[model samples]
Target: MDEIVKQSLVKWPNVPSCTGWLLLDRRGNWRMRDEAAQASGAAGVAIRHEALLGFINRNYEVDERGQWFFQNGPQRVYVELGYTPWVVRLSVDVDSALALHDQGGGGFEPAAVFVDEDGGILFADRAQPARIAVLHDHDLEIFSDHATLADHDGSLSGEFHWNAQLALPLQGIRRDDVAARFGFVASPAALA
Candidate 1:
């Protein structure tokens, strides 16, 4: 977090949180959602300002409830996630090892990799399974490289075997169960 943002919080402590006003799109773009755009179920306008993007990234954090938000000075602008909490892209450093660059602006190596029945690739942290991310569809080749088809009863599912200790379940886990199983509420608006 930025020091200026911290000081702003101390100086003006009562700013109400703003939800449904900002969104992090599936392609890792920052968007500003207005009332009209939200009501019409339209995707918000993408924010292209580099400075603002940097500021948001610097102040971004997840609450105890797993709701990620950008602290805009005194106000907390809750982000509407298009997918998982972290949206990742394939990293540039492909020679050393396959890597992922999280939209949150960091890189990490997953302890295990999992592929859902629908071909969604999920990366699980060694320490925290809840800290998972679905790989963007743009990088489907990576998914192909890491996963193999498995027979779960009669249902065929893609299974990723990265290591011995981290094994994805034999049966396919449904998309609806993902949020609950991973300890995150996909739509925080429903809670409000």
Candidate 2:
């Protein structure tokens, strides 16, 4: 959390939280939902301001109820998730090995891998399984290069080789069951 935001919280501790006004899209963009866009059920305009993005990222956190929000100074601006709480990009690090990084620019060490019916890849955090991360679409080819697939009992199964020695097994998962299976709420406003 930012020191300024902490000071604001102390100065005004009773500020009500705002929900459904911001969204973290599947592609890792922070979108600002206007009233018109919300009423029409459309994805809001992408926020491209670097400084604002940095501020939001610095204060982004999850509540005890598993709701992710950005503490905008004093008020908590709840975020609507497009997919999982995190969106990770796959890249080859300097050692020519697979690496995962979350949208917030944090390193993600995945302990489990899941593949949806649509072939979308999701990774579960090594320390916290509930903290799921979807692989950015642009990196699918990189993921494929490190994965080996096969048919097992009429279902798809695979292994993601992060390096020569570490292999994470990929399990089949349905798109609709992702949120429930992973213990995350896609729309915090609806639940709030």
Candidate 3:
């Protein structure tokens, strides 16, 4: 992991989830990838970086420690790390929509979107801590987890970390829906 990513993970130890990096090529194909790992390294095994890449391409069965990387044709993306309990940070390059979900409360809710200094989009909400599910077109589920939004300044730059949990199943979304604007839903939960 990069120094900044590592630092962010250290800052927020409670959120265990995956991090993603997305890009859209001129071909009109959307590319997305993400990394998942255990926050405390106890719930499941941790996947090696290279192994995670292999699983993404081969569609291999992954244990809790495995990470994933994927590309929708011209769109090239990879999840360098599997699933963790911490937040998965993302750096988006365009104006995108995010869909969030609240698993604890059981349903999808509205979320907020912001731009970072790098021009990346940050989708988040702090009103309630909940499990989040993000979909681009009501079909492809790009990201999902239990996350808590943090305070953001106007800078819309730099990396921010939050506490999150990865508890969504991979098959939650279908694979054939047209790519639509993404949205986020939140369901608050009580922490033990």
How many clashing pairs per prediction, in order? 0, 0, 38
- TM-score to native of every candidate shown: 0.84, 0.94, 0.19
What is the descending lDDT order? 2, 1, 3
lDDT of each: 0.73, 0.89, 0.28
The segments of candidate 3 whose C-alpha lies over 4 angstroms from its true place after superposition are 1-66, 69-110, 124-192
Clashing residue pairs, backbone N/CA/C < 3 A, model 1: none
Among all candidates shown, the one with the greatest lDDT: 2
Better of 1 and 3 by TM-score: 1
The residue-by-residue lDDT of candidate 3 on 1-192, one tens digit each, is 334434654666555433334222212122342333223322233233664444333331122222222322222233322111112233222544333332112224334433323332323344344222232232222332222233346332222222222222122122121111221101011110
Model 1 ranges off by over 4 Å: 92-96, 150-171
